[model samples]
Structure formats: C-alpha cells, structure tokens
Target: MTAADWHARAAAITPRTELFIDGGFQPAASGERFDTVDPATGRVIAAVARGDAEDVDRAVRAARRAFERGDWSLAAPAERKRVLLAVADGIRSHADELALLDSIDGGKLITATRQVDVPGSAAILQWYAEATDKLYGQVAPVASPDLAIITREPLGVVGAVVPWNYPLETAIWKIAPALAAGNSVVLKPAEESPLSALRLAEIASAAGLPDGVLNVVTGFGVEAGAALGLHPDVDVIAFTGSTAVGSRFLEYASRGSIRPVWLECGGKSANLVFDDADDLDAVADAVIGGIFGCAGQVCSANSRLLVQRGILDGLTERVLERAAALTVGDPLDEATRMGPLVSARQRDRVAAHIASGRDEAELLLGGDALPGDGFFLAPTVFGSVPDDARIMREEIFGPVLAIAAFDTEEEAVARANASEYGLAASVFTSSIRRAQRVAPALRAGTVSVNTVDALDVTTPFGGVKQSGFGRDLSLHALDNYTALKTTWFAGA
Candidate 1:
C-alpha cells in the first residue's frame, strides 16, 4: 500500500491508553493521570494513564508473581523460542502502523521509521527468539568427585525505562532479550512518545505472551521511571537514557543489594575521516545520515567529526553544501528528508548550543531554525571547535555536527579518546593497514571503519566511561536479566 494508506491505518490506533498490568488495561489505582504531548506540533496527543509508586507496586507485583509462578520461566527453551518468534511475527505484521505512529509521535522520518526501525525491531525479536533455545550453560571442572552443573535462570522481575526517540524499537531491544532469557518485565515508555509501545502490547499478547509477562507504564520519568527502578520487588533494572538519569538509576538499583542494574547511557561518539579515505562521497553520506538522520537523537550518534588537516578545507566545504540542501519540514511529508527535533525544549537547547557556536567555534553552515510551526533547527555544522567549548564537549543532541582537524593518526586517536563518553566511534579510511591499526585503539564499545552507525542485532551495543556500563543487544544482553546457579552432588 501507499504512504497515505499506511498513515490512515496507523492513525486508527486507540489514542486513549492506560497502564497494562497483569492481563488487561486498567487505570492507575490512585486515579492519577497525565497528558502526552505531540513533539512535532506541540499539541496534546492523548491523556494517558499516569502511574505513581502504588501503580509501580501493583505492576511489580504482577510481574514478580508471573515470573515466580507462571508457565513462562519453566517452559522449555524451544517453547520460549516459539513465543518470541511469534512476537517477532506480530511486530512485522503491524509494521506499517507502528512505523507511522513512531514517525508522528517521535518526529522521525517515515522512510526511516518504516524501512529501518520497524523491520530492524522485528529482526531483533526474531534473533533473540532463535537464540533462546540455542543458549547453553556449562559444567564446572571441580577437584572433587561430585557432579556439578551451572544453570542460568531468570532474575525474576525486570524493569525497563526506555527513551522517547526510539520508544518502540528500543523497548524491544530490551524486552525481547529479557523475555527470551525468561524474565517478566514492566516497561516504562517515555511519556512524550508511547503510542507505538502501547499498541505493541496488543500485538505481543496476540503473539502468545502470557498475561503479566509484559507490561507498559506511561508517566513522567521522576514518578514512574524512578518507582520502577527503585521498586523493592524488581530483580533487575535495565535502562537506556541520559548519563544524568542513568546515574540516578544506578543509585536506585544499588538500593537493593540483592539485584544489579544494567545501564546503556549517553554518547559523544567520534567519526574520523582520513586523507586516504577511498569513498569521500559515501563517507560524507554516512556522516550526514549518522548525525542528522534521527535529528541527532541517537545514543551512538557520531556528533564529533575528526577530519585529517590535509583535506579539511575542501571536505568541510562540500559537506556544508550538502548540509544546506537538507530538506527540513513536517515529519509526515514524504519529501521531507529531515524532521523536527523531538520537542520544543530540545529545540531551544539546540538553539542555545548554536548561539554559542559563533563565539566558541568556526561556524561553517546552517545554525538557524527552519521557518515552521514545528521544532526545526537548520542542519548545523561547526568547524575548528575547541575541545573545551560547550558545543564540542557536551551532547548537543540535535542535528548539529562539530568538526575538528587532526594532523596525524596518533593525534586522531588522542582527540577521539578525550571525551568522557565512549559509546561508539567510526573511521573512514581505505587502507587495511589503517583499519587494522586504528580500530583497537579507539576507546569505545563499538567501532566502524568506512561506515557510520552500522550495527548488527547479534552484536553488543553499549559504552564506557560516563556512557554507563553493561550491554544491550546479543547474548550479553541476556545476561542482564538472568542469574546463574550451581548445583553439586557427591558421587553419582
């Protein structure tokens, strides 16, 4: 079907949503409520259920009970795989609707939301589904004649606080793996953009997920998110958001010494372009798409560009020409290449960073707003940004690209390593020697050469330093929601 058909199908989703606790939709026990705003138009999207500590307690109770007594954790691994694969199919079946909801609420381009996000989300669920049956524990080599077996078990109830930019997909990024590892979850989706996540529960239930196995709580972060993180019954907390918020989660998780929290936080990643790069045009395309594609809302955004000094002038000029040509408009428009920032507050924050760019860095290109009713910032580029400037050091989190020049290979590595964040970095180099030599030295969890933001669902994604710890995606992610127990018996 065509785009308009997809939009109509997506718009038909129920706007009035409530907390998904246990098996069905219900209001908060305390009667609390809140309004969810549309980021694109600054209009009220829906009045959603607002969960407080009591709501959290109820949700946690449901999740804990389900994990401890339900058929989910005790099911054969193959059965779990079947459920998860069906969940994947469910996601794919509703792909058109989910993509449109994401596009409208999160201010992402429909092309990306439909082509990349939804399909990728389904693929992730499927991969985890297949992997559920494949995961194997080991037997210990003990000194005694006793038999020993190491078993991996679900960590009871899990709490996941997902971000607004990638609500549906990121939710699955955490939920699918956690469920595949056999844990029930209470997902707290960002209040600004939770439509797709709410809709997904129907699809998930249709996929055969047992009641209370998956739940969604919609409310402000300080209330719902904090309660979920600090809930006494929660066995593990998995979160994806900012460094500041992540720190609070770590603190809350530590409140219960019995359980550990797994965090995936911020990033100020680097994309280094060398003089010997083979595909300058392709590298430029990747660079632009990396930072501006999602309005720089990604945790692994290549916000910093380290270009070799030799080709700096020529490359900057070419990149600027392309940046100027980027189409910024309403997210619903098929011709609109770039959409608005997620919120007005985010737009103002980006504008402030742009205001400071003139005094702190060499302003190369667009740094103003696109004339519109939406939160649109011009695709901005700054050259020769000093390391200490706010525009360079902090996460601008908008469609702003800060470029720096380095003379030597060692200098590039040094410059890239200076950030307190180490989530991801990319290198554009033609030579195999450069790729081999440089990839290891980069101090990030994920590194790509001749590509930008290229990630596989099967590989791990996370960060170091202030970017937070633990991992998301892959089997490593499964470890976040599972615990191992050892059994031993003397002489068989």
Candidate 2:
C-alpha cells in the first residue's frame, strides 16, 4: 500500500481503550484514564485505562484464581500447546492491525512492525508451543522398590513488565514461554505502548485461552508495574527495561515473598572492527544497522564503535556516508528507514546525550532534530571519544554512535569489555583466528561475528552483570518460568 493508504488506514483505526483483565475488557476501578499519543505526529491516539494498585490487585487475584482452579495452569501440556498455537495463528491473521497499533502508539516504523515485530512475535509463540509437549522429566537411578521422579513444573502467577521499545514482540517473549509452561500471567506493558498488548489479550481469548489466564493491566510503571512487582501472591516477576528499574524489582522481591525475578536490563554494548577485516563496506553497513536501526532504542544496541587505528579513517567515512543517506520521516512510509523516538521525553533525553558528546568528543555527523510534528532526530556520530566520556560510558539510546580507536587486538577487546553491561557485543573481522580469539574475549552474553546483534529464537538472548541475569529466547528461557520438583515413592 502507498503512504496515503497507510495514513488513511491509521486514521480509520479505533484503538481499544480498556484494560484486559480476567479475559475481558474493563476500566480502571478509579475511573481514571491517560492519553496515549502517536509520537510520529505528536497527536493523541486514545485514552487508555490508567491502572493502579487497585487494578493490579484485581488482575493478580484473577490470575491466582485461574492458577489455583486449574483452568489453565493445570491443563494438559498438549492442550496448552494447542491454545498457544491458535494464539499464534490469531496474531498472524491480525498482522496489519497489530502493526498499525504499534506504529501509531509507539512510533515504530510500520514496515518493521509488520515484517519483523509482528511475525517475530508469532514465530516465538509457535516455537514455545511446539516445545510444550516435548519437555521431559527424569527418573532417578535408585535401588529396587524406591523411585524418584524429577520434573519441571510451572511457577504460578507470573508478573511480566515489558518496555515500550518492541512492545508486542517483547510482551510475547515473556508471555509465550510463561503460558507454554502452564503458568497464568499478568502482563504490564509500558504505558507508552499499551494498545497492541491490550489487543493481544483479546486475540488470545479468542484463541481458546481461559478467562483470567492471561490478563493485562495498563498504566504508569510507578503504579501498575510496581504493584505487580511487590504483590505477595505473584510467583515470579520477569522484567525488561533500564538498570535502575530492574534494581527496583529486585528490591520489591526482597521485601515480599522473595519470588524468582528474571531481569533483562540496560546495555552499552560495543562493536569492534579489526584492521584485518576483509570487508570494510559490510562492517560499515552493520554499524549503521546496529546503532541506527529502531532509532537506536534497542537495549542491546552497539552504540560504542571501536575500530583499529589502521582502518579507523576508512570505516568512519563509510559509516558517515551511510548515515547521511538515511531517510528520516513518517513511520508509516515504507521507504523510511528510521522513525521518530517513542516520545518527546525520549527525544529530549537523547538530545541531552548529544549535547554532552559535543563537549567531550569530535562531532563527525548530525546532532539536530528534524523539523516536523514528529519526535525525529538526525543520526549523530562522535569520534575520538575519551574512555571516560559520558557518551562512551552511557547508553545514549538514540541514533548516536561513539567512535574510539585502539592500537591492537588486546586494546580492542579491553575497550569493548570496559563497560559495566555485558548484554551483547559484535566483532567484524575476516580471519577465523581473530574471530575465535576476540569473540571469546568479549564479555557479553551474546557476541556476533562479522555482524551486529545477530540473534534468533534458536539461541538464548540476555546478558550478565548489571545488564541483569536470566535468558529470554530459546528453550533455556523456559527455565525462568519453571522449577524442578522431585517426587519420591518408597515401597515398604
């Protein structure tokens, strides 16, 4: 469809405005509402239900009831698998509507939401669904007449708090595995992008999910998210966001029943290009996609670029050329490669980082916002950034890149691993020896060789250190939602 076609469709969309609790749509108990705006045009899309502690209590109580009543939490594995697969099918059928919701509510590029985000979410659900019945239990090799069975069981009443960056996709990342494990869930989507999540709850309900099995509470983090974290009955809390907020969940867990908390937090990842790299052009392309894709809002974005001094000048020019050629405009336009930041507040945060870059490093590219109703910013690049420069150390979560040069392999590895975060890193080089050598040396949860942030459902995704622990994708992610239980039988 053309740009005009997309805009017209967006205009015609009547966003769902209520919270999803107990498998039905409802308003906050306080009767309060908050405006959700389209960052693309800075226009109010709809007034969403503003859930607080009272609403969270209702959702959690519903989830607890569903779990204890065996409505979903005690269902057969094959039955759960069927429902999850059907939910995946539901998502696929409403691809365009889901894509449009994210674009208008969160300023995600419509093309990305349609192609990558929506499809990726469905694929994740299907992957977990397929694995649901395949999980196995272990029988202990005990002496005659005595037997021990060790099995993985679901943790009940999971509270999932997801960020707004990849709203639907991230929500599915947390819920699919939780649901597949036969656990009831209460999902708290970021207030900035609650539309798609609310829609998803409806889709799941239509797909045969039991009422109260998958509830969604929409509101500010301080209210809804905090309540979910602190609730005594929640068996687990799975969160993805900033380090500061992740720490808050830790504290909340400590104060309560001390339930398992899985956190996937912030990152300031580094990308290294050695002098022996075979393809400078390919490396430059990866660099652009690494930091500029999603307007650099990704938690695992490679915002810090480390280049060997020999090829520093050459690669920097190539990256700058690509940055200059990028088109920044309306998110609904298929041709637009980058969209606006999620909000005016985020734009200002990024702008503050750029301002610090100007004072601490040599500006090689853009550092200004585009003139439009949207919250767009020109991609910015800084060179010769000091090791201590705030831009190099902090996550400037915008289209900003910090370039630093190193003299040797050891220096590159050292500089890359210098950050407190160990979420992800990348190494672009042609030599097998260097690739093997440097990838292992990098202190990141996932390292990409000759690429950037390369990950799939087949592999685990997460980080170490301040980036937080616990895995997100792959079969290992199921570990977060399950616990090992050993049942013993003795014959007298």
Candidate 3:
C-alpha cells in the first residue's frame, strides 16, 4: 500500500475510551479516571478507566468465576482450540485498527506497529490456538497392575501485568498461551497504554470468547498492577517490566505459595564488533537498530557496545553520524525515524542516565533533550565507558548506546559478562570461527552472531540473571504458562 493510504487508514482506526471487564465496557467503578496524553504534543488524547485495588478484585473475581463455573477449563481440547482460534482470527481482522491504536496510544511508528507488532501478535495467538489440542500428557509405564494414574488440570485464574512497550503484543504473548492452557486472565495493562487491550476484548467477544473468560483493568502499577500481582485467587502472575519490580512481584507472590510467577525484565545486552568484521558501516547501523529500535524501549535492547580497539574509532564515528541523522518527531508521520518515549517520566529517567554518564564515561554524542513538546531524547551515545559504569549496568530504556573498547576476545567476553543483566547479546565478526569462539563465553539467554536482535516468532525469547526469568514467543513460552502431567496405567 502507498504511504498516504496507510496513514489515512491508520487515522480511521478507532480509539477506545473505556475499559473491558467481565464482557462489558464501562467507566471506572471508583468514578475516577486517568487521561492518556500524547508524549509528542503533551495533549490529553483520551480519558480511560482508572482501575484500583477494588477494580482488580472485581476482575479477579470474575476470572475466578469463569474458571470455576465456566466450560473453558473442562472443555475438550478441540473446543478450547475453537475459541482460541476464533480469538486469533479476530486479531487478524482488526490488525489495522489495533496497530493504529498502538501507534497513537504509545507513540510508536505506525509502520512498525502495523507491519511487525500487530502481525506478530496474530501469529503468536494462532500458533497457540493450534497447540491447544496438541498439548498432551505423557504415558508412564508401570509394573504394578493395581496402580492407576492420570493427569491434567488448569491453574485457574491468571493475573498478567503487561508493560507499556509493545502493549498489545506483550499482552497477547502471555494471554494467548495462558488461555490456550485453560487459564482465565485478569490483564492489568500499563497506564500509559491500554486502548488496544480494551479493543482486544471486543475482537475476542466478536470471535466468541465467553463472558468473564478474559478481563482487563487498566491502571497504574501501584494499584491495579500490585493488587493483581498479589491477589489470592490469581494462580499465576506473568509480568514484563524492570528487574527491581519483578523481584518485588516475585516476593509478593512467593509469600503465600498460592500462585507461581513468571517475569521478563531488564537487559544491558552487549553487541561486539571485531576488526575483521566485513560490514563495519552496516554493523554500526545494526548496532543502532538493536539499541534505538522502538526508541530503545525494549528490555533486550543492545545498549552495551564492545568494539575491538582496532575498529573502535571507526565504528564509533559512523554510528554517531547515523544516530544524529535520525529524525525524532511524530510517530504518525511516516518520515519520522525515532518517536517519543512512552511518557514524560520515561524521558526524564533517560535524561538522568545521560547526565550521569558524564561522571562515569566520556559523552560521545546526543545526550541533551531536544526542543520539542514530545518526550524526545536525541539518540545518545557514550564512549570511553567502562564495562562496570552505571550507564552500562542499569537499563536506561532509551535510545542511549554506550561504547567501550576491548583488545581481545577474552577481554570482550569479560566485559560483556560483567553486567548482571544477561538478556541478549550480538557479535559482528565475519569469521565463523570467531563467532563460534565467542558465542559460548557471553552470558545471555540468546546470542545472535553477525546480526543484532532478529527474533523468530518460534524461538524462545527470554533472559537470564537479573534480566528476569521465563520464556516467551515459542514452544518454551507454553512451558512456563502450562503445566505438565504424567499418566501412569497398569498393564496386567
């Protein structure tokens, strides 16, 4: 489609003004609400339900009822697959509308939201839908004729706290697998982005998802999010956010042993460049893409760069030039390369990290906030950075890349492994030997050699260390949300 046509179509997508709870769309029960503002213009885009602890309880109760009395859990696997497949088809039908909502709600480029996130979401849902019927219990051989065994059950209600970045995609990531595994959900969408989740309910209902099976309560982390995390009825709490908050949620859930938890958290991934690398300029751009894509909002963003001392200066110069060339403006504008952060608070946090870099490392380029109404931070880079600097250690969660020099593979491996966050890392050397050599030493859940973060919909995307635990986006994703059972039968 033409760019003009795409934008025009994106403009027509509906902007939902209410929250979906228990098969109904309504204003806040507390008579309170929050305004969603455009980070670019700082204008109130819309007012949405301001869910609280009470609302969380209400949602959880509904989910509990659905799981208990509802046919969802006890239904045949084929029946469950039918409903989930319908939900998946519903998502595909509303892809344009959902993408548009995401673009407006969180200020992501409409192209990305449309082409990548939305389609990716549909694929994820559909994949899980098919897997529902395929989920099986293993048969165990038993020697005794008197023994009989069987296994299979749902965890009941699940409380999912979705992050602002890739709101709809993240929600679908956990929700699809959970529901396919026969669990009802209470989705606590981030305050900054909740419109699409509301719309998802509509699509699901239209697709024939039963009442009370899936509910959403949009609110801040302190109220709805925390409540959902600690709710006694919630059998599982799947969260995607910071490491610190993940720890707190883990602690809260572990207190009673009532429910288990899964978290996908922070990262300071290392992207190493070798002197023998074939594509230095291309490598520079890939590095930038890995770090600055989605305005550097990703948890597994390649924020740490370790270039061999031989090519450090060259790579640094080229990367800085391209990063400076990035056009930071309205997400709706097709010409814009970088968009605003999720909120003003996010912008401020990124700014603080940039400022702190002055004391810990040499400022390379793009640190100061630009003169604009939007939450725009010029794509930033820091040089002469130690492997142990605060900028490298903390998840800045912005378009800030830190560059450090290393002389050998051992040094590069050491530097990359120094950070507590081992989410993802990349190597840019041309030699297969070099890639094979270094891939083992880098401490991360996933490593992409000769590329940045190229995620397959089928691969298990997750992290190790302080970056949080649990996998998403693959067969392994199902493993975390679903339980396994072994069936034993006695043969005479």
Name the top lDDT candidate. Answer: 2
Better of 1 and 3 by lDDT: 1
Residue 137's lDDT within candidate 3 is 63
The residue-level lDDT of candidate 3 at 491 comes to 59
Estimate, for each residue in 1-492, the C-alpha lDDT of model 1 and write its tens digit.
555665576567666478888878889877877776656667766788898888888888888888888589888999999988898898888887888888878888888888889999999999999998888888899867788899899988889999988888899999988999889999999887878888888788888999989988888899999998888889888889999999999888777555787888899999989999987778788888888888888888999999999888877877887788888876766777888888888899889989998899988888897675778888999998998888878887888999989999999999899999999999999899998989999999999989987788878999899898879888889889888899887785
What tens-digit string does per-residue lDDT give for candidate 3 at 1-492? 555676587556657766677788877779888998767668777888898888888888888888887688778889888988888888888888898788778988887998899988988888988988886665455566645454556788888888888989999998988888888889988899888999998888778787888999988898888888877778888889999889989888877556678888999998988899998889988987998899999998999999999998899999999998998887877788889998899999999999899899999888888787888888999999876688988899999999989998888898899888989999988899999989988889899988898687688888899988778887677666666565555456
**Candidate with more favorable, higher TM-score: 1 or 3:** 1
Worst 10 residues of 3 by lDDT: 139-148
Order of quality (lDDT): 2, 1, 3
Q: Per-residue error at 15 for model 2, in Å? A: 1.2
- How well does model 2 score by local distance difference test? 0.94
lDDT of each: 0.86, 0.94, 0.85
lDDT of 3 at 409: 88
Best first by TM-score, ranked: 2, 1, 3
Write out the backbone clash pairs for model 1: none
Instruction: Tell me how many residue pairs clash in candidate 1.
Output: 0
Winner of 1 and 2 under lDDT: 2
